[model samples]
Target: MSVIVLDKLTKDFKNGRGVFDVSISVKRGECYGFLGPNGAGKSTTMRHLMGFYQPQSGSATIDGLNCWRDQKQLQSKIGYLPGEIAFPVDMTGKNYIRMIAKMRGMKDLSYEKELEDFFEINPASELRRMSKGMKQKVGIILAFMHKPELLLLDEPSSGLDPLMQSKFIELMERFKKAGTTILLSSHMFEEVERTCDRIGIIKNGRMIQEINATELRHSRLKTFELECEEEADLNKLLVQFPKMLYDRQTRIVRISVPDSRINELIAALSVCRLRYLKEEKHTLEEYFMQFYGGKSNV
Candidate 1:
């Protein structure tokens, strides 16, 4: 079952910027990641999905409900965390959550204790005085406590520490097991690699690629460092593998080849009197750069 669908969705802002002809879908009980660099229209797409802005063309639907026409009904089933946080200065974390609960007409604060125990957040702290990480924890708890069917998280772990980030990942896993559909939008590739089943990469307001995490990992290039007793004429071998990248300096050679061609590369390199040889798989950052046309810096 597809919980969310974007059919050629296009949005243009007054300044002539926004996503263009985007089409993607998130299946029920699946976690999909929306990834892009800063200023790449990720937030614009999310805003349209949340009904903050209407599309210039095409359509977006959530659970068969038109996002723009059924805002109220759709919102009730979705939990959202914006990229930025701005809470009332006078309210404590507890009061803020209570207010949201009252507005949603949901009672039963039983989950409050569970959230506090897992996140180690003190609800008594004033919103203004809490640390950024603490504030983020509060937002996460609020989003999950209601048990909404769909979650829209924008850079959800921006302010969290490593420990809390791990815990949040665990929480997402639990939510997935419970059959919740999640759309995670973030610049953090590692988080997406860990939590999402599939990822869509947006570049300059256009989606460039959509691939599964497992497939991406398997398709990544493998890096190898080779040192020979004497300068080796590896050009002939390199030409055999079109995907391989090689650099040689002072009897030291560095080679990178797609994972699928590693066996051929290994057989070719075996003939040389190698002083040193090491092979390593590329990380998610490397895969993103290769697929999305960017520098390999995560």
Candidate 2:
């Protein structure tokens, strides 16, 4: 069943930048990857789901509860990590975690301690003196200590190092295994590809594509990079494969052929004098760049 739903959700800013007609549904035990660069309304849509922003039109709901109107009551049911974090400078991380836990009426520090150890964090450190990565770890602990039914994470691994990022991914894997629902909004492609079951690519305040991660992982499509011994060979391939991407400087043509057509491609390339033929692995990052005109500002 769908635990999270957005119906034609829209939020307009005065500067003419905001999400328009945005809609997405995240099911129970499913991790939904929300992808977009900065200023693409990814954070805006997340805020609506968290009931931090009221929509100009449409609606957002979590488990049939109105996100905006039922936010106070729904707070306990969801864990959220905002893109930017702010902490009280005077308080130690331990104090802050305890205070938030007390508000939730949680008396147990067992899980909290486990989390601190797993992330290698010293929550007793002064909040103001902590590094950016340390602060991020604290935010992570705050969000997951309670183990809510749903998690809404915006750039959860933002300040983490490579080691910490891997740890975070492992943590998410455990969460998924335990049937936790998650909405992960991030610009990082590899993390999303690894953790999410499905993905929605949003750009310029609009969703351009939605795809199943499994399909991408097992796609029959393959990219071939072939360098020609002579420029004529490159011309022949380009003329034969109009869909091919050619580079005159490198004297190579890039062709995407399905597994079924590999033989046909091989036959066609045999007639031309070839320097080298190589199969290139198609990455989620490369697929995303296609929508962004093969370039990205972010």
Candidate 3:
């Protein structure tokens, strides 16, 4: 069953600055990666889900509950980490965490401590004194403390170091294994690629593409980079595969071959003296580039 659904959800902020006709469904136990560059309406869509803003058109729902109408009821059912966090400067991290927990009527904090230990953070310092990374750790702890069935994470690892980022990915993988549904908006391609089962790319406040992560990770079309011993050898190979991309200076040729044509490619390469050959795996970023005009702005 779909745990979250955004049906033609449009929230126009005038001059094309908000989500438009954005439609996506995240199934139960699924992690849906929301990909886009900055100001592409990812955060806007998430806000609608959180009931922070009512959509001008269409609707957002979680487990059949109307997001705007049932905002109060859904608050405790979801674990949300916003793109930007505003901390109470006067409160210590532990105090802030306690305050949120008190609002939710939570008694057990065993999971919270576990998360703190895993993230390697000491949340006893005042928010005003904490660094950006430390504040991010607190946000992560809050999001995961309740262990909600659904998680709405916007750039969850934003201020995290490389080590902490990997740790966050591992945490997502762990949650996914435990049947948690996630809507993750992120700029980090590696984390999204590692944890997401599917991805949706938004551009100009619209969902331009939705793709299966598995298909992208294991694409049938394979690109082989070949370095020929001689320029003549490279030229000979190109004659058979006219569409092959090559660098004349390096005598290196790059060709995309389908699995069915692998034998044919081998046969063609057998006639040419090649120095080296390796297949280039297709990545989510490469596929996503087509939507962003070839540059990885994300």
Candidate 4:
């Protein structure tokens, strides 16, 4: 069953800055990574799912409930961390947590305490005085403490240090193991790669690509770096593989081939006087860079 569904859900703003015709379906107990650059509609799509904005077209649903129409009931069952954190400055983190727990009718805070300790958060400080990272830790605890079956996190680790980021990934893995359905929206490739089963990349308010994590990990596509003994050797290899990137000055070539074409690569290289051939490691970040014209800023 699909725990979360967005069917052509769209919300257009006057400035042309909202999501357009976006569709996604997240199955029960599955984590779906909504990957995109900052301002690429990831947060907009998430806002629709959270029922914060009414879709201009189509619909958003969670467990068969209309997101906008059934927001009251849905809010109680979902754990959400917004991209932008906003808290009352005067309220202490401890008091804020207590207030939210009280509103949710939660009597026990044992799990909340556990999360605080795990994140090394000192919630006694006022929200106004806490650093961005500290406030982020508190937000994370609040989102997970209830143990809701559905989680929607938008850039959950934005303010986190590298260590805290890893800790967040571990927490996500634990949640998935406990059968929680999650929609994680972020620009970080590593975080998405580590926690999501499937990933969708959006650009300019539109989804451009969707990748299966398992397929991506086990893909037969491989890139190799080859050095030629002579400049002429590099020219011959380029004739065989026209798409190969050649550095004439260094006589080095870079080419990507599928497993089925390994023989073809070997044959092409065998004819060329080669110094050495090396297999280059590929990362999800590198793959994603293709969509942005080799730009890693995304």
Query: Which of the numbered candidates is closest to the native, going by highest lDDT?
Result: 3
Q: What is the lDDT, from 0 to 100, of the residue 151 in candidate 3?
A: 97
lDDT by residue for model 1 (64-152), tens? 99999899888888989888877899999999999998888888877866988899987897999999999999899888888999999
lDDT of 3 by residue, 99-153 (tens): 9999999999999999999999989999989999999999999999999999999
Tens digits of per-residue lDDT for model 4, 1-298:
9999889988888587888888899999999998876688988888888888999998999999999999999998999999998999899999999999999999999999999999998899999999999999999998999999999999999989999999999999999999999999887788888889999988878888888987887674789998898888877777778998888888888998877788999988888887888999777898887666535333
- The positional error of residue 179 in candidate 1, measured at the CA in angstroms, is 1.7
Model 1 residue 159 CA deviation in Å: 0.8
Error of 4 at 63 (Å): 0.6
* Best-performing candidate as measured by TM-score: 3
Error of 4 at 213 (Å): 1.3
Off by over 4 Å in 2: 220-281, 293-298
| Tens-digit lDDT track of model 2 for 47-82 | 998999999999999999999999998999888998
lDDT per prediction?
0.83, 0.89, 0.91, 0.89
| Model 1: pairs clashing at backbone N, Cα or C within 3 Å | none
List CA RMSD, all candidates. Answer: 4.9, 5.3, 3.9, 5.0
Clashing pairs in 2: none
Give candidate 3's error at residue 140 in angstroms: 0.8
